[model samples]
Target chain A: AQSVTQPDIHITVSEGASLELRCNYSYGATPYLFWYVQSPGQGLQLLLKYFSGDTLVQGIKGFEAEFKRSQSSFNLRKPSVHWSDAAEYFCAVGKGNQGGKLIFGQGTELSVKP
Target chain B: DTAVSQTPKYLVTQMGNDKSIKCEQNLGHDTMYWYKQDSKKFLKIMFSYNNKELIINETVPNRFSPKSPDKAHLNLHINSLELGDSAVYFCASMGAGRGEQYFGPGTRLTVT
Candidate 1:
């Protein structure tokens, strides 16, 4: 069975501080990884994705993720957190083939302090 | 322009009622999906449609049905909804066999 694990349930960071959200996956082969963000009462927005080739990928809103094959993890990071960055973040894994269903992790709620 | 959109951003209904949530994507993608986010905030895939064909159907209850009129639209219908059905539903689309999925603003369904 394939699954995703986001270790942190909730994380708080100061508005100008750096942030990191950890994610790990269980899969037999190389898996496509993604990070999505959701605002309160809104649908998810794709932050970034890692299919192959590059281990590090940059995304919108100044977000980035690094896929570590050895650890089966794809962690999301931001150099400087903003007030609007306070939202829920989800990590997902999908098979490399076409038409693969996404298995999502329990999201991490981010709280930015002033 | 919104890549994907779902109607009725909020829905509140009584138990045992039947309701439908419609989704449309203007991105000309070949695949669309429906996901359910439970109270615990666990997002799970319920259905996936590719080129109007059912590609992925997660072990969802039979009371839930997904209908795709075309490659661009996928609608979910729930019959005899139960209290456990209260959750936010999201519609997403992507190019076939791709990992990047564009999600629509979810529809929060509250079954009282």
Candidate 2:
């Protein structure tokens, strides 16, 4: 079974501070990894994804994630956080083909303090 | 225009009643999916339709049915809804090349 784990339940960070949300997955193969952000009452928006090639991938809103196969992790990072980035972040794993169901982790809520 | 969309942004109904939620994708994607997000924001996949074919159906209850009329539309119908079904339902579509999925605004279902 392919599953994802996001350890932090909630994280508070200061604005303009670096942010990193850790994610780990267990799968049979080199799984397809993704990060998604969801605001209150809004649906999820893709932050980034890792399939093949480079270990690091950039996404919208100046977010990026690095895929570390040895650690079985794909952690999301942002050099400087903003208040707008205060939302719930989810880590997901796919079956690695073009179209497969994605299993999401328990989300981590992010709060930014000015 | 919205890439993916769902109808009845808000649905309030009594327990034991039946309801249907419709989803559409104009991005010419071949795959569509349905996910449920609980009050605590725990998300899980319910069903997936690829090219109008039922591809993945998780351990969803038989009362929850999904219909795909075409490659661009996927609808979910829940029968005899329970209070636990009160959550936000999202519709998503994934293109062939793009590993990312685009989600709709979501339909909030309230079963009272």
Candidate 3:
């Protein structure tokens, strides 16, 4: 079974600081990975996705993630995070050509302090 | 215009009552999906439809049924609801063979 693991349940960071959200996955083969953000009472918005080539993938809201096969990790990063970036982040894994059925992680809640 | 929308943003109903949540998308996507987020914020896929055809059906109980009248609309109906059924349900749509999904604002169901 394909599964996603987001180690952090809650993280607090000062405004304008660098942010890194860790994500790891376990799958039999190379999996399609994605990161999504959700605000209270709102639907999830895609942050970024990793399909193939170019291990470093850039996404909306100035976020980027690097897919590392050796580490089995795809961690989301942003050089500077604004207070508005505080939200729940989810890491998901899916099989290629499988109609995009995603297996999501428990999610990590980010808290930004001004 | 909302890319994906779900009706009845908030639903408060008594136990044993039946209810339905409707979803619509205007993105011209060929596939639609339903997901449930529990109290702990763990999301689980419930059902999926592609072009009004059932594609993926999770381990959800038979009390829950999904209907897709057309490619752009998918509705979820629950019968004899229980307190355990209370959760936030989301509707999402994506293009065929594409991983990008557009999600609806979700409906929070509360069972009393």
Candidate 4:
């Protein structure tokens, strides 16, 4: 069975501080990893994805993620956190060639303090 | 222009009532999906349709059925709605051979 785990349930960071959200996935074959962010009462917005290219991938809203196959982890990082960055972040593993089915993590809630 | 869109942004209904949530994608994607987000914000895939054909169906109850009249529209119909059905439902579309998915504004369904 495939699963995604986001270790941090809730994290608070000061504005302008560096942030990192941890994610780990379990899959049998080559993994397609993704990072998504959701604001309050809003649908998810894609942040970044790692299919089969570079280990580090950039995404919208000044977010980036690195896929570490050895560790089975895909963690999201931001150099400077903004108040607007306070939201829920999810890590997902895509089942390639399987109708695009995604197994999502439990999600980590980030809160920014000014 | 919205890439993917869902109707009835908010729905409040009594238990046992049947309701439908409609979804349409203008991106001309061949794959559409429905995801349920619980109050705790845990997201799960419920169903997926590829080119109007059922391709992925999770362990959802039989009361929930998905209908795709065309390649661009996928509608979810729930029968005998239970209080546990209260959650945010999201519609998403993905282009063929693309790993990225576009999501619509979710429909918050409140079953009383």
Q: Best-fitting candidate, measured by DockQ? A: 4
Which regions in candidate 1 have their CA more than 4 angstroms from the true location? A96-98
Model 4, stretches more than 4 Å misplaced?
none
Model 3 ranges off by over 4 Å: none
Q: Rank the candidates by DockQ, best first.
A: 4, 1, 2, 3
Instruction: Report the lDDT tens digits of candidate 1 across residue range B27-63.
Output: 9899899999999999999999989999888899999
Output the lDDT of residue B77, model 4. 98
Model 2 residue B59 distance off true place after TM-score fit, in angstroms:
1.7
DockQ values per model: 0.81, 0.73, 0.68, 0.82
Give model 4's DockQ, 2 decimals.
0.82
Tell me how far the alpha carbon of residue B89 in candidate 4 is from the true structure, in angstroms, after superposition. Answer: 0.7
TM-score for each model: 0.97, 0.97, 0.98, 0.98
Q: Cα RMSD for candidate 2?
A: 1.2
Q: How does residue B107 of candidate 4 score in lDDT? A: 97
In candidate 2 the C-alpha lDDT for residue B59 amounts to 91
Interface Cα RMSD of candidate 3: 1.2
DockQ, model 2, C-alpha based: 0.73
Query: Model 3 over residues B1-112: C-alpha lDDT tens digits?
Result: 9999999999999999999999999999999999999999999899989899998899899999999999999999999999999999999998977877888999999999
